[model samples]
Target: MRYLCLIIAISLSSSAVFATEDMDAKLDNYRSAVGKLMKVLKPELVNAMKSKGPVAAIEVCNTKSPTMTNAVSQETGFVIQRTSLKPRNVSNTPDEWETKVLNQFEDRKAKGESPKKLEFYEIIENDGKRQIRYMKAIPTSKPCTICHGEMIPPPVQAKLKELYPADKAIGFKVGDLRGAFSIIDTITQ
Candidate 1:
């Protein structure tokens, strides 16, 4: 009887370890997908800013960001998107889970954690479907300030208002959390 109990304990322990490892692997895959998406976005944004200005860069973000995300999602078999606590695009509004995570990220930032390195992942069971969700925070940088800062130039402000009338994505300072890349990968058991 004691040996049977010991066997059961070992089995449970091994199962927990295996579950943790599986979660880690899934998180790694999500990170790689997000990284690829960023690599595509950054160069395009930089070139646009260099050639035209912040207005053009904003256009690149508005038009090309989603296309790049979709292409990466197709390649990785994951749903990828960007969301913010205060979104510029209405379509980028955070869902319930995302909102909760974003709030937690804000709390972490308030506690002096580096937003650039902030990330979260979990495996969730919804309606009998298992899905792995990951989020990586986007910290505001110098270039980002040209469009998303507290003091936007008049022309840039005009362009932003024209593009996003209800934009709440301004007033960000350097090192602030701008938003996050969200990735969800369904796990088929």
Candidate 2:
């Protein structure tokens, strides 16, 4: 009986350690995927803004963002996308799970948490299949204001209207929560 009790205790402790390690691994994978997506997209946006202007940069986002996201997804073998409560693109609107997560992020930000450091992940199991979901908050920056700020230039506004007629990703200032990068993946155990 003593040996059985010892063995059970050890097993429970070891499983806790393994669960923690597993969570760490999942975080690493999710963070790397977000980094890669940013790396692929940020430079082009910067260059577009620098070379032409906010209007041209808007075009780049309209035409190139999906391609860039898809390429990153292919490279990383992960399903990744961006979402927001107020999305410039309708397709980028948050779904049910994402909506709940976005609201949580907003509440966290309101409580003085740094948006840049805000991230959430979940391990969901359904019918014996495991899925992982993660989201990292995206904070609005100065450059983003050129297109998404309260004072967008007329040309930028016209272009934005032309491309994203139903856009809601505006009226943001630096340090505001713009949205998040969301990733979903299934992992084999």
Candidate 3:
């Protein structure tokens, strides 16, 4: 009677707590993976920009980024990469879910959310498989403007055209939504 009701309440509350803890663990893992990737890639980009210039930095993005991304993915055991609504790389065109998140990110930004503080995640069950999908907003900074800005140097622009025939990643202002780092993890239970 009363005792049975108390037991059920405790059980339900404990399950909710466990669910929240699980989500926290997953979020920690996803954040670590993104940090590792930025760590591995940022130094190279800085050096390339300092010594060889933006055109050379473009080469870094074209040649080095994919290899580095794959290595980081292997190290973290997650499929992670950058994607955008206007992707410089055709291969980085967002999938349906990613597109939806990117749009939501935009909407949030419009409502005064800081780009660096913008993030979203969901555990989705699709076709009997569970997946955790996450995205963190990539804010456009001044340094990135050299390559991805509205006013590009002719040489840099030419190099970009040569490298990416259908580049649409330009025209971003500082503090704008450049894109996002996306992560996907398959959960088996």
Candidate 4:
């Protein structure tokens, strides 16, 4: 049984690495799709801010769906609206998410480069081997800080609370990495 367990572990680790690679490829595709949308959306959002005001721009963000999957906001641990590919699910606790991705952003931030985005790779450990399974993250910008920043406006705070009752996503600055792309691959076990 011990030997069987070891074999299973080794197999899982190997599969996890392959999964991570596959997820990375998918994340790249997702970025390309969203990058195209941002080109048009950014300008429009900026225009709305100038004419209708920041609220209008925020409203647009609230409604926009850059991807079909929901994206995580690293700042508050809140998931953003329709963005990302399927299989990108939220964790029950902030710690769970942090262990998986947010801490990496913090590490990058400590290095002086803001984590503008993140890619989550699922790592599986079996025996003595480790491998990545999948990855994903969200794009961040100045506006993202309004809600995720160190000081969230009351309206934004209220909205966030409503959307995420157990939210911890907040206290971020402009140009900071708001979230990362996550990758999850299937284990070949």
Name the top lDDT candidate: 3
* Model 4 lDDT, residue 62, Cα: 54
Q: Write the per-residue lDDT of candidate 1 for residues 1-189, one digit (tens) a residue.
A: 999999999999854643767777777788888788778788889899999888778889898898888888898888999999989999999988889899999999999998878999776776777777789998898888888899999999999999899999999999889999998777754
What's the lDDT for residue 81 in model 1? 95
**Candidate 4, poorest ten consecutive residues by summed lDDT:** 80-89
User: Residues 1-189, candidate 4, lDDT per residue (tens digit)?
Assistant: 999999999999855555656666745654554454446566777777678766556666555533322432332232332222111123423334335456665566678763444444445654454433333345457766665577777876676666566565566556545554343322333
lDDT of 3: 0.88
Least lDDT summed over 10 consecutive residues: which range in candidate 2? 14-23
lDDT of each: 0.87, 0.86, 0.88, 0.51
TM-score of each prediction: 0.87, 0.86, 0.87, 0.49
Colliding pairs, model 1: none
> Which parts of model 2 are misplaced by more than 4 Å?
1-18, 126-128
Candidate 3 matches the true fold with a TM-score of 0.87
- Clash numbers, per candidate: 0, 0, 0, 40
lDDT of candidate 3 over 1-189, digit per residue (tens): 999999999999854543777889989988887877777777888899999888878878887988888887798787889999999999999999999999999999999999988899987766676778899888888888888998999999998998899999999999999999999887753
Q: Against the hidden true structure, what lDDT does model 1 obtain?
A: 0.87
Better of 2 and 3 by TM-score: 3
Candidate 2 structure quality by residue, lDDT tens digits, 7-126: 999999854543777779878978987887777677888899999887878777887988888887888787899999999999999988899999999999999999999999877665
